[model samples]
Target: MPDLKDLNSIYLIVAFVVPGLIATFVRAQFINGRIDKMTDTVLGYLVITLIYYGFSIPVISWILTFEQGLLKTALWWGLTIVGPACFGLLLGVAAQHGWLRWMAKKLGLRVVHGTPSSWDWQFANCYAARFVMVTLTDGSSIAGIFGTASFASTDPTERDIYIQEVLDVDANGIWNYRSEPSGILILAKEIRAVEFMKEL
Candidate 1:
């Protein structure tokens, strides 16, 4: 092992560690997971880096065979930086769409989903706007529009919601726009259930 103060050791760290961090960060942007802990994140980066390197060994070997030249430098750059970035993007997309999971299922392997919870999945996939009726634990229901402006908490533990354009639900179940409140923020603890209805 090289000394920490040595220039070669520093270069080795930069060549390997930076790419892994970049890939992990890129993957996190597309996938939802409980990665709040520092230790867990660091460990994940290291693990991902190792796995990436393992898979990229063939390419690394091929690059090493080239004599020192501009092409060799470019290939080295691809191995160190561009390669990992592209790998992260493709990996994240594959995981996000369950392509990897689907394939793993064929092999009878146990695998977990990328999303933290169903709440994130629902809000993420529900692109079209609709009338949302939120029932509270206190037995009260608030009706509003779950449009582009509305928000759902992505935090796995926090199942909060924000409904834009409050509505009045009459006895006949007709929804009318409220004149007072613009939107309502419902906390996770208070929420009992949520119903989405198509606009009439």
Candidate 2:
């Protein structure tokens, strides 16, 4: 037979830790930034878990206290997992859409941002129908259709790109698509800058 003390400890851990891990994982998908140290990460999760439990505990108290059998088990898992998931997703969406940033700005925290870099912010807003103009370090430039096939690296360290349907610029600086090359890959090292356009 399992020790009651051991079982209580397990229950306490499950009640706190699992939901936190799930919440953090879900939140990370929307908010990107520095990787915290392990201790900091653990403390962050614990805080998130506690805050979540404070609100959730009251709502699920009856089900937890009285429900039995498979229904109880299902509800318990849902409370522990799905509840936190929804909480995290709400947080993520808020953070991603700048609701958090807007609040921070109102609070005069001017530097608060959802993405780690301007590059990320720009690429995250990239639309399939837009145009991309990439200027090279060697005084040349590449124009392309930023269509469905194009890609920009999300990795902060890897600024490379695969732009589809390469274009040529006329003397008047208008962008027109080239027929031969279907796509092109430009390494981060070669790029000096990039610009986006709604129309070529």
Candidate 3:
């Protein structure tokens, strides 16, 4: 006893709502801790949905002229499910490659990279260490320790300071220190600042 108007409205609602919700949920689950991933996923879904409807609508209208209820509904649902999934996958791949990092830099965000440069053996009776922080032209920052500077072969004029350890600051302002292995140089760009520590 459902009227044609109500049935049509339901179909329209389902066509829009189902795909949006699924895309949002999939993006939230797969892309964690990265803002670019989330944004790309949403944008991709929007583009794909538009493209799908653009081509499908004319064909669907013709089909509706011949076929009625259940068959048309099935076709609509099938397209809804497939379109968002494909879009989300594409966005996820793009996000993993640092596209967001480049964009963020263009927006004048601060980027920091930290590494070790030299060591003061006199300061630390047990160990001598140097640190370097490379704050890029961007806003995002990366901190890492330079376990060995001799192998780094970096130019002295680069304003690089050797640090013993790299400190990673979370969004909450908590600091976690990670040490690098000897003879290995850690390179990060778009950093804020770098600091060095000496223990006697």
Which candidate gets the maximum lDDT versus the true structure? Answer: 1
Q: What is the TM-score of each candidate against the true structure?
A: 0.73, 0.78, 0.33
Please report the TM-score between candidate 2 and the true structure. 0.78
Instruction: Please rank every candidate by lDDT, starting with the best.
Output: 1, 2, 3
Task: Tell me the tens digit of each residue's lDDT in model 2 across 1-200.
Answer: 22447988778767777688788778767655334554567667778888898888676887867657998898888889999999888888886677877888898887646577888777665644678889999989988887777877866787898987888999999867666768899999999999887853
Query: Which ten contiguous residues of candidate 2 have the minimum total lDDT?
Result: 31-40
Global Cα RMSD, each model: 3.6, 4.2, 16.0
Model 1 segments beyond 4 Å from truth? 1-9, 65-75, 156-159, 177-181, 197-200
Model 3: CA > 4 A from native: 1-6, 33-48, 51-73, 98-200
Which clashing pairs does model 2 show?
A: none
Model 3 lDDT per residue over 1-200, tens place = 22437988667545654565455455433334112343345554455456556756776676667566887777656668865665555545444344555677899875541112332212112233443344545655545454433223233333333444456768895656656432323343322454443321
Better model by lDDT: candidate 2 vs candidate 3: 2
Give candidate 2's error at residue 73 in angstroms.
2.2
Top candidate, metric TM-score: 2
Per-model lDDT: 0.80, 0.78, 0.47
